[model samples]
Target: MKRLVFILLLVFAGICCSCKNDDDGGCVGVDCLPPETQTGENTFGCLLDGEPFIPRGGVNPLDCVYQLIDGERYFNLEAAMNDAGFNEIAISITTNAKEIIENQTYSLVSEFEVGGVSGKYIFNGDIFDTDNQNSGKLTITHLDIDNQIVSGTFFFDVIDQNGELREIRDGRFDMKFTR
Candidate 1:
């Protein structure tokens, strides 16, 4: 019995020592986080869920990065960097949906996930209410720097804890962006 107790104490001490510091301010274990960046055209360098943060030289059609929490939306690196204090950030754009997703047309939505806590994003001409990191949108309008004069949607679906996608059904409504 004494040997067992001694072993357990040593194990606990080791676990306590293994925890690394998270300098990001907002998250614990922030350094363990993965960032997927869109580089070049329709390509990306990603080190995502369960994978080590190894920059994939380039992959086709980059998918938006996200994490799921109780049916609400959470933003990853891009969105987090866009506005740290501001939970939501709005940027007007002028382009089609396909163009924006491809990064061919500039956009302003970046986040890692959508739900444990809610963050807001304004896209096209509507506000998106994020639930469990699942639902949100991004919109753009005609701005002086760029002028396409079109509408687009930045929709998000909840992702399961295992890094799997949870299907979202279609609906029509105006979701509000808190920012």
Candidate 2:
């Protein structure tokens, strides 16, 4: 009976080891692909401090909000890395309808003034935003106004309130804007 019990324990161990409990930094869902891979609908990804930074929505949920204000189109994309407020990131891009066309490139400005395409990275205590000191570019690879599908790539450098600079690279977003 002891030998039989030992055998059962081994079987249970094997089963437990074979099960997959997939997750992405506490975010659950098949859409939560391993951070190394970056491709999804309504997805945004980049590298932060040489680590994969993929944004996800939780109970509060991330949003890709779009609006046409004063003849300019604004696209605001946000991702919550965690349930905590300090772990979120926001990217806002403003351009005219003509500038947002497919296969076009738009300049990313660090100015806090109007019509600036900027990025913000917020961590436990570190926060950074595009300022007039840095430069970046955004390329629109696809835009479907009828279906409201917008896809783009971007990279930028932002400065923290304390004057520290952080670079965000390999950024990509494929989102259907919510009007």
Candidate 3:
């Protein structure tokens, strides 16, 4: 009876180990985030107020757009997800700069101006943005214009019109850009 019990315990242990979550491509926990990569894997994720915010749905949840207006270049990176009630939540980072260079960091600002960056959070039709009272940083780790791939990391605090504050942290994205 002792030997049988010991064998049963070993089998249980083996089963528990095998059932552990080991998916590297998926978020692991409540505070889990997507892996930061320089390749254009169309991945985007962040932590919103300590909860994981990952883009969902089947079509174009992550997007990067590069445009040239009045001879000035600008880029917009956006990630969006749908909640349980089908409400859309999104985060957008836009830069009003002449050019985007690799290994450069941009400041999040309230107003749109030359060489300034802006961050926005939209949920249920309410928009919050980084203002003078709140700010954040976006660092471009890799930018390949020829291949149209861009990767970056960012974190910010934004305020809505009603003065509600939302903290976004550990943000990262790797995606292909469209010009």
Candidate 4:
């Protein structure tokens, strides 16, 4: 009986180990968290090519960068791995926005730029400002003007410099701004 119990225990351990090593050793099956709904604790994550993309510039409590210039508002957010080989995933939004409110949807225009870059910027090589062929929107779901906390969801399809169309989806952000 003792030998039988030990064998069963070993079998259980093997099953557990296998369950945890799903290809990339990340969560497997439907239990894995979707990137759009994964934002908690003032962090950001999204899906690119069905893989998890989280911020790599260290987990910042309030890393969402914001700026106001000439009656326009801009927001920039990014994440990357520690290695230089990894491309930094980033998004910048520009608006003639004033008094941000919940449920405000802004269409991302191709001509919008900040510091010489377009509004719908992507780090994926060959991809530039969202091509004129597509349109994107940024929706503000929550705004705490007193605390300066903001939450939003966005997605865009942009053409690369080579004329290839790329889709970025399931994106979400919750951040606090200084200004």
Whose TM-score is greatest here? Answer: 3
Best by lDDT: 3
lDDT for 54 (candidate 4): 53
Q: lDDT of candidate 4 vs native?
A: 0.57
Runs in model 2 with CA error above 4 Å?
1-40, 83-86, 89-99, 123-127
- Relative to the true structure, candidate 4 reaches a TM of 0.64
What would the per-residue lDDT of candidate 4 be over residues 1-179, giving only the tens digit for each residue? Answer: 99999999999999988875454356632224234332334755555445555555634412565566677665555544332566545545444333445888766655444422233545643336654567676788877756767777777777655566666666677766667
Alpha-carbon deviation at 144 in model 1, angstroms:
27
* Overall local distance difference test of candidate 1: 0.29
Among all windows of ten consecutive residues in candidate 3, which has the lowest summed lDDT?
Answer: 22-31
- Rank list by lDDT: 3, 2, 4, 1
In order, what lDDT does every prediction score? 0.29, 0.63, 0.84, 0.57
lDDT of 2 by residue, 5-101 (tens): 9999999999999977655545533233333222327777766545556665545345676677667666766655663445545444443333366
TM per candidate: 0.19, 0.66, 0.79, 0.64
lDDT of 3 by residue, 1-179 (tens): 99999999999999998875743355444447768999899888888877788887837678899877888888998888887789888999988855778999978875376777888998866878787778999899999999999999999998765677888989999989998
Q: Model 1, 1-179: lDDT tens per residue?
A: 99999999999999989877644434422233333222212211111222212112122112232223454323221221122343232321111112222222222233322212222323222334345445444432211113212222333444444455433221111111110
